[model samples]
Target: MRTFEYRLRPTKAQEQALMRTLLASRKMYNACLEDLITHYKETGKYLHLYEQDKHHGKEAHPDLPAVLVDTTLKRLHRSFTNFFRGLKEGRKIGFPRFKGATAWNTIQFRDAANCLDNGRFKAPLQCGGRMRVIVHRPLEGTFKFARIVLRPSGWYLQCVCETPPHPLLKKENAVGLDMGIRYLVADSNGHIIDNPKHARKTAKRLAHAQRNLARCKKGSHRRKKAKKKVARLHEHIANQRKDTLHKASRSYVDGYQTIAVEDLQVSNMVRNHCLAFVIADASWGMFRQYLEAKAESAGRQVIAVRPHYTSQTCSQCGESVEKSLSVRTHVCPFCGYIADRDENAARNILQRGLQVLARTGPSSSRREGPEQSGESPSVLKREAAGL
Candidate 1:
């Protein structure tokens, strides 16, 4: 299934209705949580969603759509399921907390027919009518479901549809990627994609807005306005980062038949206090996810190679050279090879990926060292140069 999201332009009345829907949904969720806790504690048994949903019409706002209530109950059930699943797996789990009025951002319609039709989208309470949807592209396949989400910027509609995959493209080029905070990505071809550092770039504006928010009196109109300003800045940063990622991933998928990247555990890496913020801002994991998803659609390969020693090992000669994080260049004394540290890692990643493909017959996605290829250093250089 593929999903599409479009910004929604709603009338002032429609906006009010959407806001009320969100508030009602949040209230119902908190009530359901309370009921579940009380039921379980009293009876020593689970209170399922069906039982909670049965009392919806009597307890919930009479005007609220049934779909909204059903979806909210389903969400509560899923949250509980995840909480138990995490506990069972020995992971730290927090009990679900009550959602604040402003915290609830999304309300989904389980049935597509309720909200969407040809050139028209309507909601309950006589608030909605024909909307001016900016159809950036044609939406394909059967619509499955639609959701109304409120962001710091504005409201949007996300629709999920079942789409048949296109025939795979015919391409033979492959490359390796090394992700870094300094540069967004370094490829095997010695090309460096600069990191935009969207959050860092917009830090001053965000800080100013946050400071204004702090100075405003709580529950005052000024504070609400200030809060929205802060949210807008955050939304801007997110949009900028997402745009950059989409462009970079599109290039990789369109240019290469196969792409290899280091299997870096970003979750573990973030534990280091010094670089935690930068690492999170870099969004290396998000980039890799986009790569894999796009590659799948383009009929390409995305391989994850073991990250160990990729930075220290010589790409020209099969020898290890120990270097600290401070070292920006790989100076291999054994073969007199000198290159940017990340570029060297990228080359090694490419060679290792090729070795994996040769051994596993181009279908392997697992991390395993197989026999090295017969290609020489000159051949790799030529390939990188597009010779």
Candidate 2:
């Protein structure tokens, strides 16, 4: 399956209709949540959608529009299903909540009939008067569904389509990558992609915009304008970061068949206040996601090795040396080898990743840890660790 996104344009009247639909949805969402809470309080269990529907079906109210009520009830049902699923998966239960005034501004529809082509797919919403689609890239298969999304700057529609998988070449050579704050990534082949600090460069502008926004009175026209300016700045930063990740990951996928990387827990890394901005700017997790998707499409392999000793252990000597964040150079006492810390770490990661691949085989190549096939060494290790 492939997805394509296009910008959307709607007339003033159409935009008003869309807003009304979203308002109805939001009102319904809040009503359902209140109903659930009331039911749970009285009966010790939440009311199901069928029960709620039956109760509301008998009610006659001047304030409630039929369309709004129906939309709200359906949304309530989805919320309940999602809540139950999350509980089953040992995730925190999510309860539906009311949308604030600003929240309703970002409402969108998914899988609308008009957006789909022939019962097969929905058309892309275009800007201007005519329904136009600029083919940014050629697609291979039948389109299935299109989703409308409201962004801070404008609206966008994404179409999901199905296409036959094409054959992609698999090279024999492999490379390992080490991600760091100083350098974005260091490869086993002694190549380093320097950290651009794109976010940091734009931080002052973002800060200024935010400060200006904060000074504006709430609900005032000035506040709204300031808020939009801030949003635009954030959107710009996000786009730049996304572009950088795409370019960097695409280069790696195209150059090597086997890609190895350290399985760093990004959530934990972000806990450090000093490193949070840098970590967010790096977008290591997103980079890994892109690598996986591209690698899968290209029939390439991605291996993730435990990050535990990659930085401390010498790639050539297998000896551990103490190092600090301030230490940019890796000086191995055992072998007297000197190199950039990230470069040394990348080489170590490559060696360890290759060792894992040799032991577990290609099917267990994911860097996210191990396959659940009950045979991968990393999986077994994770099981032993109670992961």
Which model scores highest in TM-score?
1
Model 2 regions more than 4 Å off:
46-98, 101-112, 116-135, 138-140, 197-199, 268-282, 364-387
Q: Per-residue lDDT of 1-387 in model 1, one digit per residue for the tens?
A: 788887788878778878877887788899899999999999999898787777887345575677777888899999899899979975556788899866789977787665555555655553354554555666788888888888987888788888875636678888999876567789989999886665566767888988999999989999999998988987887777788888998898889988898766554432333332443434677888888877776678888776767887999997998886667899999999999998998999999888878878765245555332222223222222331
What candidate 1 gets wrong by more than 4 Å, as runs, is 57-61, 89-94, 126-132, 197-200, 211-222, 268-282, 364-387
lDDT by residue (146-206, candidate 2, tens digit) is: 5555678776657777777553776788898987655678898889887567766776788
Return the top candidate by lDDT: 1
TM-score for each of the candidates: 0.84, 0.78
Minimum summed lDDT over a 10-residue window in model 1 is located at 373-382
Clashing pairs in 2: 115-122, 115-123, 116-121, 116-122, 117-121, 117-122, 304-367
What C-alpha lDDT does candidate 2 achieve relative to the native structure? Answer: 0.67
* Local distance difference test scores for all models: 0.75, 0.67
